[model samples]
Target: MSKITVLVVDDHPLLREGLIKILSLDDDLEVVGEAGDGETGIKLVHECRPQVVLMDINLPKINGIQACKVIKEQYPETQVIVLTVYEEEKLVLDIVRAGANGYLLKDVEPNTLVQAIKDAVCGKAPLHPKIAGKVLHQFGQMAKALDMNNGPLLTNREQEIVRLMAKGATNRSIAKELFISEKTVKNHITNIFKKLEVGDRTEAVIKAMEKKII
Candidate 1:
């Protein structure tokens, strides 16, 4: 059988080297390329066309989430498994939306990580247990909130954002109204999405209004 082609993308030189070293010990796995940033990772993806990509979230130029999105868009068959230290709920959802095949933490055991990469090539998600818990719990909360017709219990600031959203206000407009940065507005909206279990601003607004939370 041909070795499973892989690419390692991370901002830290040490981490990238370390992952390469681990993969090197596996006879069936091949490290085709390594990149220190997401931009280089994307470039190398095209050049190497690896079967699996081990991606990190923090990087200069383009972030791993955006890079994963681009890569999956262009090469839907390519498997990108996010390997990061972040356990943030929103980051998990973001990467999931970007079409990551798996989510593994930095502290994963070497054997487990290796097996995860192998699983990715076979079209399976070998999500870290903690990561899987968070993803499932999030959806569970959303489902329960929806079933109970109670909504996700938005914060005061999040309610303000949703009310503005009902008026079709843009993120910039909401930020200006709240005197917070645009990124803050976006984050608040993300929370709103989680609470309400809605996908976009329109859906969020409708849910909030129907529940009389706005």
Candidate 2:
């Protein structure tokens, strides 16, 4: 079996070392590289071509959000998971918009962290429970403030898919739950994005909430 390659990117040396140690314990995970800031992290990512990256949002140069955007734009195959202390709704939304595959708080347990990395590599959006709750709450508030009657109405299937997406379900899991193929799920999601006028799952959920479609 092949191991998942990971790049640890955080400004704190001790935290970086600790994360590397924790990730190294899992036989299926390999810590291929480390970087102290977002800039170097991007550089290492290009060099090492790791499948997954554990990134800190608060970096000295070109914060994680920017780095994530660049990485995704340049190498969409590489998945990024934001590992940060901040759970602010704005930061979470920003990271999501920047194309991070997952968001985990710094206080996450070692086991959960490892699972998150694995999940990200499998195309799952592993958002911390607290962060996910906050995002949902924010979206709900925005929805309440908007006029729901004005936007495009989603079909029952699309609405269901968006609800699962809000809960951080991956395409595979969504397919399993809905009793459909992953390809069908992808097709539905593409339609959902078009109707919602959003680019990704996070934005789709936000838009769905804003339009009260889910």
Candidate 3:
């Protein structure tokens, strides 16, 4: 496979420089460019056409979430991994909704950061363990908040699915535990998304919790 091209975006010069240095040690990866702000990052991304972008959430001109949305919209093939200090569920959820493929806390080990970059390049939703709980709780809260009228009016079976989803169960596991087919699970998810007005599982769970439907 070709080397993965990466772009670093952060307002802090030291952080960007450190990341570049860390990534430089990886022979399989290449740092294509760097930017000091979100807008500049977006422009560099378009110009550099990097396969992956290590983006910081706090930036000068535009916020990282907005930058992620712009980059993802214009370059669907480019994957973004948020490298931030924020561990709040709301922030993580917002970033994911904006199209980030992965999230890593700022204090992550060098090796882990390298692994996360590789994972993001390979289409995996890599998340720091410390932040994973927050993400999962966000999903649970979403499942708990749903009410019948506004959220997806889940059937008893679908409700079961939502419950497992809130607990962070994958579709295959849900299928195995519930004795249902994966296709059936997917169909339910589609209906769930339509009913809840959500595009992804995390959002669906959040909406469900908001309405107390699940």
By TM-score, the best candidate is 2
Expressed as tens digits, the lDDT of each residue in 70-188 for candidate 3 is 99889877889999999888889899889787889999999998888886665456788877888767766665555447644678888888888766576788899999998999999
* TM-score-best of 1 and 2: 2
Weakest ten-residue segment in model 3 by summed lDDT: 143-152
Q: Estimate, for each residue in 33-86, the C-alpha lDDT of model 1 and write its tens digit.
A: 999999999999999999999999988999999999899888877889999999
TM-score attained by model 2:
0.89
Judging by TM-score, tell me the better candidate of 1 and 3.
3
* TM-score order of candidates, top first: 2, 3, 1
lDDT of 2 by residue, 79-110 (tens): 89999999889999888888888899999999
lDDT score, candidate 3, position 162: 80
Ranking by lDDT: 2, 3, 1
Q: How accurate is candidate 3 locally (lDDT)?
A: 0.84
